[model samples]
Target: MPDHPDTVLTPSASAAGVAITPTSASARPRGRRRRRPLTRAGSLGLNVLSAVAGILIWWTLAKVGFNLPTPAAVAKQAGHLLADGTLEQDAMASLRRVLIGFCLGCAVAVPVGFLMGWYPVARALIEPWVQFFRTIPPLALIPLAVVLFGIDETPKIIVIFLAAFLACVIAAFQGVVSIDRTLINAARVLGAGDLTIFRRVVIPASMPYILVGMRIGLGSSWATVVAAELIAAQEGLGHRMQSAELYYDLPTIFVGIITIGILGLLMDRVLLMAERRLTVWQERR
Candidate 1:
């Protein structure tokens, strides 16, 4: 297209000693590159905002004459319990159970999942059972687990294990199965045997999936911990909550729920940090 008749195109040599060029998509400044998110700061801000919002709702509802306990009431109860060391006792016991069950579940799940995903015969045999049992809720099996193991640490641990095991197995198995076939082929072409391929290519490739499973399993573990401690538990958050419920102590109930939430959140962040550290070389896709 010719320059418009009204356009006073300057001569190349007479453009104030600078070369003039036609405008084009390439000539325009690229739109400012999207800035990377301030993830830590943003996360902190969001959590703070959530806390503030929750407090505001609590205050508002209490002021509007709701039967629910005020935030102060909850705070008072938490403080009273904390001062008497009751809170710590329960908290520590709960933490102990959670860690024990979670770690054991992951230890078993990861290896079993790896085998299932890595070996054809192993997978064919185990996948059916995994699928079948995974569909059952941890709570649903509580009756049987309790009856079998009794209302001791065994049953609670078993409940936690079920929660952790199912989630982790699924993640680990998926991670292994989802590995790039090309990567495996490349390794094989380079003379990597099946075992070597698994240890090298498969393990690294499946790490993200495994980490994701760990995160998910931790959440499920927390959810189950409450139920696990509901029976034959003398000093756990769940026991305290059940006791509170019997007396309609809403503040204690809220505190227990909040404690669980905070604990779970912290565990998740720790897992995330571990994942990032381990997978530093992998471009997060």
Candidate 2:
């Protein structure tokens, strides 16, 4: 008998009067191997190193007259903005807009997406509109939004809302549609009702897609808000950048850019954590 099912005995060894037993499956080396993932500390260290390297590159570019401000100069400008409460006010304004629009977008999107995915009638009715709107950039509607909703917070919020909505809805719709039919059939064969299958199988399987969509939507919201603020708005990082651009304030521009990046990164990290927590059963590299 072979040592294992996978083991093979060579005829040459048998002819030589030697029993040639191949290594057991457990003892044999694997054909493919995966590298160990970095520990949390190592990941953090790498992030810091990357940030440092980026700063060094930026400094080098600035020295080469690339019309960029040095990191120290940007930091100094940030301190000045902070001292006068300008940074805080601008940050709060942008944060409020993003939060409200993003939340409302998600609240509406999940249900709508679920409906479209689960019901053929809903999908037929809603999909065309969704695709049409998606092709039209949210920024392009800024003018219409302003005309209809006025040059207030409403228009800005509306634009952001649309951006987030489009991104999240598509993600959710794809998630639901992409669920394995075999799982649904299995559940049905086991005498599971539609509701039971939806609750137990569909929801869990679609969650990863929903979360990914939300992340994409969140990015879209930020982008839209900044663009919306660029026109006829006050008290936002985008508005501040616009104001700075008038006088060629490179340091202030850098500060605003860095602040927005940091805020977005922090929010993204929160979503990532949620994804990890909620989708623990999902395999990842």
Candidate 3:
């Protein structure tokens, strides 16, 4: 043992017949270091590389006798669509429906979800209907929607709304339900009221879940809007694709598919950015 209790006899020190004083040990650098995240330039380069690789693979598949249209053909079709303003009009139509439906659904869902999760009485009253509707696929409701609301924008928007609502509501409910009970108790012990605790603790804790749900709901909205458009009326990517399918226009179909994917990916990225901004206080890997 060292004469001074503050001296630590570490393994390396013992082997070298030296004592590591507390001050020296404290002054030593830590072994483990944090890894640096990718720089924006590096991340951008990687994304570009990935996209190029995907295109190369797609090109190879097209050359290998796949029925898929080549990238060039799809681009040509896209150019034609753009030249005539078909793509813009269709994209705007779809975007309008998705935005309106998704926004309204999320607006309603978050409060309802909070109520369901926070109040037992509310849960008892609301959960059964939520679950029942959730089980019935939004696509399956097309006939009912058409019959009730007619084959106009109303039914299409309603279907998209249902899709978004179900996804977000479940996410929000789970977020609230999954909050740490200890946090609430600690807040109470700190003389915090229910409203204060909820505002400070519950909402922050539940935000990640709510954001994840919103992302999912957004995807659901897009998917439902496309399918709704396919079954219903005119101007939209889904309608364009359905028309192309009848004529076996592979390039047009590919163009629609790519357009939808790109739009969805862009929207999801926006949501992801929002989530990161909102959850800055939350720890991440």
Q: Which number leads on lDDT?
A: 2
* TM-score of each predicted structure versus truth: 0.86, 0.90, 0.87
What order do candidates take by TM-score, descending?
2, 3, 1
Assess candidate 1 and give its lDDT: 0.87
Q: Model 3 segments beyond 4 Å from truth?
A: 1-36
Q: Which residue ranges in model 2 land beyond 4 Å of their true spot?
A: 1-33
Best by TM-score: 2
Give the whole-model CA lDDT for all candidates, comma-separated: 0.87, 0.92, 0.91
What is the per-residue lDDT of model 1 for residues 108-137, given as tens digits with 9 covering 90 to 100? 999899999889999999999999989999
Q: Per the 3 Å backbone cut-off, how many clashing residue pairs does candidate 3 have?
A: 0
What are the per-residue Cα lDDT tens digits for candidate 2 across 125-204?
99999999999999999999999988789999999999999999998899999999999999999999989998999889
List candidate 1 stretches off by more than 4 Å: 1-35
Structure candidate 2, residue pairs in collision: none
In angstroms, how far off is 151's CA in candidate 2?
Answer: 1.4
Candidate 2, which ten residues in sequence have the lowest lDDT sum?
A: 1-10
Q: What global local distance difference test value does model 3 have?
A: 0.91
Better of 1 and 2 by TM-score: 2
On TM-score, who's better, 2 or 3?
A: 2
